[model samples]
Target: MVGTAARALIVSERRITGLSQVVIADLVAELGPVWQARRDAELCDRPRRRAVGAGAKYKLVFVDRLLATLVHLRHGITHDVLACWFGVDRSTITRAIGEIRPLLAGRGCRIAPGLRLRTLADVIAHLGATGQTGIIDATEIRVRRPAAHRRGRNRFVSGKSRTNAMKALVVTDDRGRLLFCGEVRAGSVADITQARDAGLVDLLADTVHLEILADAGYQGLAAQTYGQVVTPPRKRRGKNLEQVQWLMAHHEQARFEHSSRRIPVEHGIAHLKNWRALARHHGHRHHLPDTIRAVAGLLSDQQATHKRKLAALPTGQSR
Candidate 1:
């Protein structure tokens, strides 16, 4: 257990870290022995320098490193602040981030396996069995502009936000649990273009019951793909939608209904953005994809934890 002052400096349990203290403690309980073994092996890799008191003990323990990394991801706090918070050197903070990020990313990537809807048969089997579906959409993460002389500076400037950013696709179950994320691309890339390049369209082509919910930016995706795709109906400029299109209450109302089901993807994206690092990354832009994937994995783990708790509750109990 951490001291009160240390707990105050670290993230609050009320905040999202992809894992609560209960979950994180459970994880530590399972991984602590393995991590100590790995640390021993690493130490064995180098012979000890016999000079007395040459190397001092690390300020933060292994569990602290893990906690600190999650805090950084949760709030995008600076390394200097983290060092001060953990009573460690700035380099130690950086090293901890580098080490723990991949583990988190791996956890995020594992969420994809629950989506067994790879083929049309699989999709049919899934919906027929569970009566549920998935949604797909693109979200952008802000990044520093590329160097002036860089080849693709124009490609990274987003038309939507009119700022430099990276684009990624997020897929979620209807309940807003993230299924997949991270086909990270330049901001200027069109949604349909990225969807096709990411093989999202191709994958959906083989699925029948799992619909891909997107905005009209993916207008042509439906024509080129076989799986169900839903989007708001297009409206023409200089003409009111009711007058120029379908009847007064029909078309516009249908779009509203579709949006009701489609709104969950936005919530999923918002959940990811809760990790402010994804909102504005200050590090190497190349690592953005891994960061996004890492966060997605944390979101999945958090969702699973919630589900397990809810399941453990007595039936008919208010959530």
Candidate 2:
């Protein structure tokens, strides 16, 4: 007889890990060999007969250990609960996460898009080769408020979100494939500032054309420098939007069209937040960049796999 927690973790992966069985199996195939190698090296480094309680041996198999850590990440489940489910001590779950988190993050970096825009030409060529038109936006993740005595703590308060949050600039292709997630910044930082700091505005007008789709929050940002910056028309302080449009020959309908086009990036951001860690972060804030990168890569791989499976189907059938 299997326990409820065990059944949830091992049998219904999507319930506990937020990933389908097929994807989990694929991940094991990809990460199993490296994990085994590391485990073997650690075992070799240990004494033949260790001191009592210096280290307790792991009870679960390699696959279960990996699955346990992933479930913790996806569901933000407590270690004590995980220990009960896996029939291991709480410390074992902690050790597993300590070892596996970095591996998963490293795997994420491999699939993430590179953003080395050394020159304007590089920006143009990179975007052209990877994707032509893309959306740029900022997302803020909520975090526990730091104590008042903590230095530089005030920087994390975001007026926009009205909470203590960390912000990141996210860029994605028209298809919603994540291109890059900028380094985490204090939520007080503006979206345009994040983009400029991340070199999204490094392109020169005289060079190749780069179309960047952005929301109204990023108005008047390198409008002349970058090939083009598409943003919605902003209303003047004293005038209504309709009046401003009528007086300035601006069409409000165009703004609606622009927003319609930017929806995919919004969906991408929502997809990244599905892992729950981003929903409410309780860990070290510094680890967020790695976590975001890892999730993006996993999503990209999952999407690719879905496409491949769809392609294999017969012409008359639908997935």
Candidate 3:
């Protein structure tokens, strides 16, 4: 339902989709074939009564569908607003998002063609192989509070943020490039508990070269992983600090150094949150995991492209 002028305007300005023109072009080229193949497979599973071109044509083309989905995820624009922009019904926007989101999620965080990191295990393997230090952290996203009578409603309340929220563990490389985003959990869940539930300890135990830097929230993980997990140094609980000022000063310095190394994860989390879909959720909680993974994939592609550009720049020139 988009008019010719409106479509042209959107095409001319890539910022409407929150992606560079190059990135959007790349996504369209990559997604077109995959989407067509999926539709073909669906037709094969359930034969259409009419021929492929015999039915009513879609108003929004494949590119428009992909653009709408990206805009929604990047800006957190509602289906109603999208409907007005595209001159279509809200259901049209909803259907397009439902169709496109899963494909992006399936692509995962793409470092290169045929080398997407889809799970935590893939992330760990890549880190070990590349000998790069990883930073791990958890972030909370606000969600709608459940009804009073809903079962386990209290589980959604986060003791740290004092709100109804969900928590997700994000893993990034030393330079703050995202590598993986784990599944969402109840906000009330502790950081260490979430890591344990995700089998992070087991994964770290298996790797010899992979090291992860984390904050004080993951205090006990270092011992569990035989020191593969690094956390800030803790002060002696029952010691007379004034009597051992020199030792206390050393511990403070150690903590400072650990924090400096772990700061990149904070930047990574901020980058992820820049996608409004992850900043806050207005949709069903069940849909959040897919959105998170999909956004991470898109962001990773953007970051990878940016890194390539930086590397291409001449020495002594500003990026």
- Candidate number that wins on TM-score, 1 or 2: 1
The better-scoring model by lDDT among 2 and 3 is: 3
Quality of model 3 by C-alpha lDDT: 0.88
> lDDT tens digits, residues 118-204, model 3?
999999999999999999999999999997899999998999999999999899988888899867899999999999998999988
Worst 10 residues of 3 by lDDT: 235-244
lDDT of 1 at 300: 75
Question: Mind giving the per-residue lDDT tens digits that candidate 1 earns over 1-319?
Answer: 2455676445355474556766577546645676667666877778786543356676677688778778888889999988887777899999877877766665443333354222223433454356567677899999988888977579898999999999988877788877778778899999888888876566655566656677778888777765367777765443675565555456678778878988899999998898889989999998788788878766676777778789899999989
Q: Output the TM-score of candidate 2.
A: 0.80
The TM-score values for the models, in the order shown, are 0.81, 0.80, 0.94
Name the candidate, 1 or 3, with the larger TM-score value. 3
Runs in model 1 lying further than 4 Å from the true structure: 1-12, 16-18, 29-59, 109-131, 234-249
Candidate topping lDDT: 3
List the candidates ranked by lDDT, beginning with the highest.
Answer: 3, 1, 2
Give the clashing residue pairs of candidate 3, or none: none
